[model samples]
Structure formats: C-alpha cells, structure tokens
Target: MRFLRRHVDAVYDALTVRRSRFVRVEELVIRAAGVVPGLVPTPQEIAAEDGSIQRDKSGLEIDQGLFLSAVLGSERCGRHLCHAMLLPRPEAQALLAQFERDGRVKLDGASVHRAGKAAVVTQDNPRFLNAEDQTSLDGAEICVDLALLDPTTEIAVMRGAVVEHPKYKGRRVFGAGINLTHLYHGRIPFVWYLQRDLGYVNKIYRGLAFADDAPPDEFGGNTIEKPWIAAVEAFAIGGHCQVLLVMDYVLAERSAFLTLPARKEGIIPGAANMRMPRFTGDRIARQAVQYERRLDCDSPEGRLICDEIVETGEMDAAIERVVKGLTNSGVVSAAGNRRAFRIAQEPLDMFRAYFAVYAREQAYCHFSPALIANLERYWNAQSRKP
Candidate 1:
C-alpha cells in the first residue's frame, strides 16, 4: 500500500512538472469530472482554469486537489486518484513539433521511474518508424530508461499484458459490457420468462439431469423459446433482432475472439462487438457484421484479422512476445492499419479470460490483512467529502 501511495504521489509530482507520461492521467481525470463533457480542455482553457499560470515558467503553485480538478475536471474522477492527478505532456514542445512534422514522437534516454530501480527500457519512441523512416535508422531511433520502485518483477510482467498489446494489433481482444445485458434480462416479459423457464429448469436439471442422464424437461423451455422468438419478433417489429444488434455487427468483422466457445455466448458477444473496432479498422467492421463469425489463429480468417498470434499457453510468455514485437517493430510502425488492429483485439480476449479467472480466484482465495486494510482505507477516504 505504501508503494501504491508513493506511485500516486509521483504522479502528482509529474503532473506538476508537465511530463507527458501524465497525459493519460489528465485525460482520464478531465473525462471523469465531466468538466468539458465529451471534449478535452485546450491548453488555453487549462491555463485559465488554473489561475493563468505562465507556461513552463513554474511560478504558480496549486493545491493538489485544485490542480487536479482544473486539469482533469470533476467528470473524469475515479478511484485511481493517483493516476487522475498525473498528466502526460510533451517533454519538449520543439521535439514534439519536430515529431509531428516527421509523423512520430522520438525520445532519447528519457527515464520512466517506478519503484526505485531504473533500467534502460527502450532507445526511442517507436512511433518514429513510419514509411518515411525506411532508410535512416540512426536519427529515428530513441532510447528509454525505466525505473521501477519496490519492483515486483512478476506483477510488472503481468501488467505488460495490457500495456504491451495495443488495442488494434493483438490477437486477443478485451472489452466491458454495455448496458445491454441489464436491458435484455431486466426487461418485462423477458424477466418473467427467464425466471419461470430457464432459471427454474437450470436449477432442477443441475440436481437431477446428471444422475438420470435424462434429457431435462426444462431444457427447451420458455425462456429460451421466447427471447429467440422475440428476437425474430424484434427483427420484424423494430427492423432488427435486438436493440443492440450493433454488437453482433462488430464481432463478426473485426475480432478473432470468437475462436473460443465462451466468447460465442450471446451476452458476451455484444460486448466484444463494442470493443473490437476500437482495435481493428473500419474495413473489418463490414466483414464482422456480415459474417458474425469468430476467428482463431489456425483459421484463414485469423490471418486476415491478425498478422501473428502469440500461441504460448502461458499468459506471461504471450505478453512478453507482444511487448518485444512492439518495441522492436517500433510503436508507430506497428500502429499502421494492418498491425495496430491485431494488438488492440487480443487484450479484450485476454481481459475477458483474466476476469473469469479472477472471479473464481476471489471466491476461493483468502485475503491478506494488508489487502483488507487497504480496502478499508480506500473506502473510508472515498467516503470523505472533497
């Protein structure tokens, strides 16, 4: 917990320094605060909000909360208070400008400090390797120095599962469910039918079906019957099978997660649709919708969906492959239409699998006193007024 707190404090300091690493934090906080609604605040708006501090002059000092509120606003607030406090900014505007002109952000010997130890992370902002950099590797390459505090190397490695794979290029895709689940299950006739038919039968079959090897009487019941019938009804009545038909539309074209049977389930399929496109291109959107198919590494469609699949059974190895691939290929080079889509899609699948495992682990594992204490502290702090 102390280590986590230190990371939070570091984020606050970095934001004040206007380091670009905090850019993500600033964006998150601003979005949480609902200060600008759908848009981000401009540099001018940020300056005005924070009492017109002179750019890069460092004269003004603001309370941590006030500074955060101004930059991130209230709408984007979240439980990750430390992250919200830090925002990433360009280290040097001149360098940024040059990168923009050259279509990349290149950094040299820039350090990412974590726990306490610092290691050379990379030599450059990998984004510099667009088609333009085909000949000149000397000027385009940049290096990074990473510092990890309290360095739990294993956890750091695990975290890379999310960070190393860009949403667009990875084979596994991860995403959260929209409100559609509640809408479908919580609605009127649907709820009644499910409770009466599927819920009751599933419970009874659990007790009796295995023992008798009999086809459970509740197996083909009303709940299943009605929604599917209703789906057809919906298509006829509303010109679509469901209010969230967009889910199916997205999954079929852009994602490879359909390779797993678990992902093929109706509810999760919708969530996959929403997240897949953010990683893949619009060209795949049409294909996903048209086919409503799931793809795997061995499938012909998988090749089209992702260039390479990290096939290691171990999660850590798979993630390492992704990180090495991205770093070596250069973030920018990997982010083109073809590669970026693959990176983006894999995480959604990984996250979905991870969460399922986590849920089961939570049900079985015991909590440490330190973890409980941290949870209590977090709840208490959240209970306090701002």
Candidate 2:
C-alpha cells in the first residue's frame, strides 16, 4: 500500500505543481497507468487469488483502488477532478451551436430538442434497450450541456427514445442501466462508471461548473443550472433509476417500474446508495439495492420516487402539461430553490466524500470475478453480443 501511495502521490504532486489543464477521471487513470504498471492491473492479476475472497487487500487490484481513492479523496486533487467533470465536453460548443441553429442536435445514441420552454434530452440506444455505454456517454453529456445552457429553455426534460428491442419494439424504454454485454466483452472501461456519475449524471443534478469559479459546493458556488424533469416510459433499471433520485420531478407510466439490482450486478449502483434513502427511507432502499426489490410505479412505495403516474400512452401529453405547470409560475427561483433543498439534503462536500469511497470500492467490484459470474448467471451475458 505504501509503495502504491508513493507513486500515486508523486504523480498527483507533479500534476498539482505543473497546474495541468483539466482532465476527466478517465484521462487521469490513463495517465497514471502509463507511469504505474499495476495501476490498471491485467486480467491475470484480477484472476489471481480468485478475486480475493479472503478479503486480502494485497493484490494489484487493491492498489488500483487505493491509488484512485487517494487521488479522489484529496482536497486539491479531488476538487479539480470534480471541476473537470462538471466542465462542458469538448464538443459541447459545436453541439450547442447546432441546436441553436437547427433547434436540435441528433447524435448516434442521443439527441436534444427544444420543446416549448423546455429542452428535452432523449436517450436512444435501441440495440441495447437504451443502455448506456461508451458510444452514448459523450453524446449524452453534450446534449445535457446544451439543455441547461440553452437560453431559450427554462427547464430540461429527460426521456428515452423509442427502442428496437423485440420485447418492447417501438416503445419508449427509459434505460436498461449499464451495458452488461459490453462489460462482459471487456469493452466497458472501469472509469466509465465514474465518468457517468461525475459527468452527465452529476450535471443533471447540480448543473455545470465554470473553470474560473470556486468548486460548486451548493453553499455559495455559482453554476448555470435549471430544474430537470424525468419522464420514465417503460422502466428505469440500475443507473437509470439512480438518475430519478437526482431529478427535480419524475413522471412515470402507470405500468413502469424501478429497480437497483446492485447485488446481482456486483457493482455499486452509482449514488443511489446515498440519495435513495432520502426518498424511501433506509429499509426500502436496502431492499431495492441489496435484495433486488422492484418498485411498481403505481404502488405506494414507488410513488416515493415517482411524482405522478400517467397512463402508458399519455406520457407525451403529461410531460407537456407538467413542463407548462412548472414554468407557468415563472421559474426565476428554480435554481435557487434547488440549491436550498440541496444544501439541507446533500452538500457538495458530502457527495465528494461519498464518491471518494465509491471510486475505490467500485473499481474492486468492476474486476471481481463475482461480477462475471453474476452476469452470466442472471443476465445470460455470455450468450449475448455487444
């Protein structure tokens, strides 16, 4: 551990002293991997000791986790990491320009449209049931940036695009969570988890952070933000369900459902652990995350997360009405109220500390053999193709 810390600290110190330009968690991991070989341990290292069932923390995988936790937990390093995450994506400007010119920017897996007073961002990964993966990450984040930054829009709406899956053909399915087939095929990188949470997902919750400003700590930090509404059509599973926790309001179809099967997936379900209990209390949250309890949208328990349940085909009209209602009162105080509520519930420091632990633990889980076994047993991952 000491040896690993020395290398990580040295690299961290160099970046600090050099005042390096902003880089996302994924970039930082790649940079560190270049300097420290085991920072991104090989599959052999993960297979050795059989995923450390004895709780032995001496593997290179543990070192990877420790190294990341050390960097993410640091006051200087972690703050910059968070700031980099909150900054607009590289293609954000172009995309925003296109949206302003054409009223929409449609990418491969996602798109954003201007609808009345709201910017509606749609997730459109049809092949995998609107699942999130590398192909969709940047596009989704950029579209989110456009949504909040658009001067013409007072609010933002998140919804799923019609998917092509045989079971739910031409139906709007919110998301299937992570791309397990990609994960099993070694296409999903470890940093993808952090990127999703710290980048677009966090942007949806806390808004965009400026480069010259102080860390957006919810107390006095300045940010460009707007209230977000989530329209859940079919179901929100795992990461997508976690997103509902951050939204200002959630509108779900009567037949829709929600789940956080972290135990079955062998991974932390983003920030659901920290934010879900606030809505459903700790016991039900535990049941959902640990025991795979599914919450039906019409049920009393599900209502805690979903604000209104509409008929299956009434989602479009419901979204339009809700957006009108939220903006009709004049949303001048929307961002302020969001910050006020956030301060009492979850300040920036609390979220940062939680993610510090999450970064390390999730890295370990990502490489654990149990994750592979769970995917094969539960998801039939081996039979599926990316």
Candidate 3:
C-alpha cells in the first residue's frame, strides 16, 4: 500500500506537468515506478487488489488510479492528494466510468465530435410538417444547437439585447426593464400571489375603510402624486417597447406590428383591480396596467393575478372569460377607457383608500427598528416619571 501510494503521488505529479497528453495506463505505472523506488508492483498484484484485471488483460489495461490521480492533481493540484491516496486503482476506474456515463467527464475534441454526432442524430429527426411550420420551428432548434455548443449563450444573448436596445439604454427604460425582468424571472413571486389571489378582497376592505374613515375632501386630492412615478413609468413603457422590438427582431424580424403600450398610470392593472374589482373582473387583464403593489399568492384574490393562473384554473378562468366577454361587448370601455374607469365610484374610492392605508403601513414597517428603540426609551422615561 505504501509503494502504491508513492506511485500514485508520482503519477499525479506527472499528470499535472503533462495534463494535455493522452497517457496509457502502462506508461503511467512505468513512470510512477521510476519516481518511487520499490514501488513497481506486478500486474498480478494490482489485479489482486482491484479484482477487475483479467488473465488475458495485459499491455496497458487503463489504470483508473493513474488517470484519477492525474485529473485531481491537474484540477486541484495538491489539495486532493489525501483523497487520491485513499482511492485505489479499481475504485478510481469505477468512478471514472460513472463520471463518463453521467456526462460529467470533460471531453477532448474527438470525444466531443462523437458526442455531437450522436446528439444530432437523436435530436434532428425528420418531420412531415409544411414549409411555414418548418421555418417557425427552426429558430428553437437553432437555439438548442447553440445551447449544446455553449450553455451560457442564451443569457449572453439576453444581456446583449438589454444593453444594446435603445429602450434599455435610458434610465426610465432601464428601470422598467429591471422591474419586468424581475417579475418574468420569478424574482418577485410574492407580488403575483398578492395581486392574483387577494386583490378583490383587499379592494373591498380598502374601499370600505376609506368611505368610513376618510373625509369627502380627500376624494379628489392629489395624494397619489410622487416624483419617482413619472420617471419609473416612462422607463417601464420604453423598456417594454424595446423588449417587444428585440423579441420581434429575433422571432419575427420582417414583421412590422407594434406591441401594446405599457400602462404608465402609476399602477399595475392587475394589482389595481385588487382595489377596483369591478373594473378588472376575475380575469385581471387590466391589472397588468396597474402594477402598483407587490402581489401575494397565498390569498384567494391572488389566484387570478397571473396569465397562467387566470387562463387555466376553475374560478379564475371563468371570471376572466366573463370579463373578456364584457370588454369585447364594449360594456367596460364604452365611455372611453379612462372615463369608463372613473365611472365606478365605490370601487375607485375603495382602491384609493386602500392605497393610502398600504402606503402608511409600508412607512410604519420601514420605521419599525427606530420605533422599537424609541418605545424602549419612552418606557424608561415613564418609569422615572412614576
């Protein structure tokens, strides 16, 4: 075992120096034996230890230990010397075989070519589709091919598009793009839940609260105004338009259709519907335009906030369909979209009142750390007063 250990160390060292070389198992053993005196164990001895060597297997049966020792030394140098020492030749071969099977082993050019050919044969099957269909399918197929060549290619493409597109260049466009990108990438799943599931219930709560607590003078006040809204909206609309254009460029380059405008009305349509249920309905299409609040998914109102949720689920789908029908019939948008939106007094009032409450809630939440410290000080002062 000591002889084998020293030989393994020598083989590891050799592997680090000539990592690019394709060394045979016998060659590695010969080199390792030369480095460590009295370490030249016979083939029979190796077979006895590993139980994998056949009587007829002579003249360079692959020494998995040598290969592994080399690989470890090449990849991590001396850091894995202890691990290499523990793993015997047969054990190492078994591990190498497993790595190869799992596609975890790095391939040289010839190996890569062989694998690529096999993948091409498997994936590029013949189809009886028409020319138009074939053309449409080609883009995704090409994407797959590129992905095989380089896994990070898609991310690179998206990053490049975001940086180069005019809409993504400006502050407004960048900010909106960031928000949309975060949502699309599932970075803010909570927002979707809130808007889709509990929106309507919260809207009712807010409206009732507003009517009961707020004065009539608060009705038409510019309480919603904020300096950041205009900039953020502009950026969002511009970024959305740009992204649409990029997608078109890649997917439908020759087509000249326009994307729907990003709603810059200081609210996400779906989220606003949480405050104004009558306007959005259960489908929540208009809520896309009113993205003001973080969506929560745990509540019942949150179920209809997203496109997939609204389209497929039982209650959500049914509500969405009805809303779509009404919109198509011009019942919802008859008085011009803006004027129609303002027609529902009760829901709108509720939405505004809820917005105010939400803002206050956020403010208090933000100040919680300071508030706690202040409370402690006040308690101490009260003790002295008594």
Candidate 4:
C-alpha cells in the first residue's frame, strides 16, 4: 500500500502522458499501479465505499486514493486524472475509419436537433431498440459534444430515435443499453464504453468540452452551461437505465420500466454502479444493479430516478414542459447549481477513483466464462440471432 500510495501518481502520470499509441486498458491500469498492483475495477469495488480511501481483501490492503482522488475539491475536469479517456484513441479511430470506409453509416446513430434553447439528442438504432454499439457510442459522443459546444443550446434532452419495427409502432425508446449482440460477438471494444462514460456522458453531467483556456473544468469553449433532461419511454434497458442517474431531471412515461440487466448480461453497466446509489440509495441501487430488479417509472423507487411520470403517450409534452420550466429562471445557474450538488452528493474524485476500479474489473467480467453462461441461461443469448 505504501509503495502504491507513493507511485500511483507516477503511474497515472506516465500512463496519461501524451503518446502516439493508446495503451491496452488492463495493461495501462496494471502498469500504472506498479508494485502493489491491481487492475482498474470495472464493476463496483468488490468492497469499497464511494469516498473510502482504503480496503482490504484476500490479505491485500489497497489504496488508490492518493492519486485517484485528485479531483476532489479540485476544479480540474476529472478527465485530467483519468487521462482524457473519453477522447477517441487508436482502436476507436481505426474502427470508425473502417466503419466509414465500408459506408456502413452516415450518422453514428445519434442526431441532435436544436430549437430555441433546447437541444434534443436522439439515439437512433431502432434495429437494436436503440441499443448502443460502437457507431452509437461515437454518435452519442458527437451529439453530446455538439450540444455542449453550442452556446445557444441551454438544456439538452436525451431520447432514442423512433423504432422502425412494427412491434413498437413509432414510439421512441430512450435507449436499450449496450448492444448485447455486438458484445457477444466481440465487436464492441472496451474503450467504446470507457469513452462513452468518461468522454460524452460525463460531458453531459459536467457540461464542457475542449476549450484551451476554460479554467480546468469550466464550461466555456463555446460551450453552454447546460443541464440535461432525460425523456424516457418504452425500453430503458441496462446502460440506458444507468445513465438516468446522471441527468438533472427525468421525464418518463408511466409505462416505461428501468433495469440494469447486468446480472444477466455478464458485464458491467458502465458507471451505473458509481452513480445509481446517489439517486436510488445503496440498497435500491444494489437491487437494481446487482439483482436485475426492475422499477416502473411511476413506482416510489422509480420516482427517485425519474422526476415526473407522464401519461404513457405524453412524454413529448412532458419533455417540453420540464425543459421550459427549468429554463424559466434564465439565470444560467444550472451548471453552477449542478456542480454544487455533485460536489456535495457525488464528488468527481470519488467517481474518478471508482473508474480506476471499474476500468480493470469490468474487462474481466466482460469476457468471463460465467458471462457467457449467464447470457445463455438468462437471455438465451447463445441461441438468439443477432
């Protein structure tokens, strides 16, 4: 622990130092840890609290806070500590290049529409119920970056694109979560999610992109100080449900249900582990994330995650009402207020350190034999056609 405590920053510093090549996830984490080492925990810590500084298990005492908690009380975008992980790296670049070269998609599965002060980000992959794939991740990154970058976009609303299938009519879904098909086939890269969570999703929560002189993590850079409202309907599955925890407010249809499905899927649920507890508290978060418990948007526990439950077909009106209501003050304190709340409730340092654990451990669970077996038994993923 002593050795790690001393060298942890050096490892992070060395790992994040500009390089021509992107390091492998586990390699980067382990190499950075040095002597008393461990991979970044991809799931929630097997046994650590959010702000906790230490833990002991398997006869090993571990502490990464010396380096990982650098974001606490610091204005620095937690990104600096995690090494700008959200930025597309080498593998991401190549995959995007190949996808484009094949003419596979014109849009990365996400589109942004602006009207007045609101920016609507539609996650459009109806074939997968708006499930996220590499393209979708890239698209979300682009859309979110666009929303944050546009000074006129005061509030961003995230929703899924219309589903083409007859089964669901034309109703939109918020998201279906990670693309299990791509994941089962090994097409979704680890960094895809890393970048999604740290890169764009955090950008949604933090409200800033690239501006050289924006004061550490300030929301400048031609950026708007925006708070996001999640408009959820139909299926809000897995990573879909996970992201709601980060939103400023959620307007959901009464018919909508939320679930992590992580227990069945055999991989991590992005940053849900870190942020879910803040909305639903520890017990509900555990039940939702660990047991695959489902919450109806109108339920008491669901209300904690969702601010207002609109009638089944009224999500559109609810979204407009909520967005207009929020911006009614028009003072632009949303960003500062959001920052204040996060600092008190779920500080960036705790999240950064949690990512350190999530980065390594989630990789293990992603490819574990148990994951395949769980999918076979629960999702029938073995027999389901992509």
Indicate which candidate wins on lDDT: 2
**Runs in model 4 lying further than 4 Å from the true structure:** 1-106, 209-224
lDDT of 1 at 184: 20
Tell me the tens digit of each residue's lDDT in model 2 across 131-233: 9998898889999999988989999999998999899998999999998887776666666788899999999988998877777863456888999999998
Which residue runs of candidate 1 sit more than 4 Å off their true CA positions? Answer: 1-179, 185-256, 259-284, 328-386
Instruction: Please list the C-alpha lDDT of all candidates, in the order they appear.
Output: 0.25, 0.84, 0.26, 0.65
* Model 4 per-residue lDDT at 375: 64
The list of candidate 2 runs beyond 4 A from truth reads 3-10, 16-20, 34-64, 218-220
lDDT of 2 at 85: 89
TM-score winner, 1 or 3: 1
Residue lDDT tens for model 4, 138-178: 67776666655555657888898888768886888888898
Candidate 1 vs candidate 4: the TM-score winner is 4
Across 75-193, the per-residue lDDT of candidate 1 in tens digits comes to: 12221222211111123223433432433333331212221111111122212111111121122112110111112111111011111224433322221111112222211111121
Model 2: number of backbone collisions: 0
List where candidate 3 sits over 4 angstroms from the true fold.
Answer: 1-337, 345-348, 365-386
- In angstroms, the error of model 1 at 178 is 3.2
TM-score for each predicted model, relative to the true structure: 0.22, 0.91, 0.18, 0.75
User: Candidates 2 and 4: which is better by lDDT?
Assistant: 2
lDDT of 3 by residue, 164-242 (tens): 2343342111122213222222222211222211221221122111212222113431111000001011122222222
Model 3 residue 117 CA deviation in Å: 59
For candidate 1, the lDDT comes to 0.25
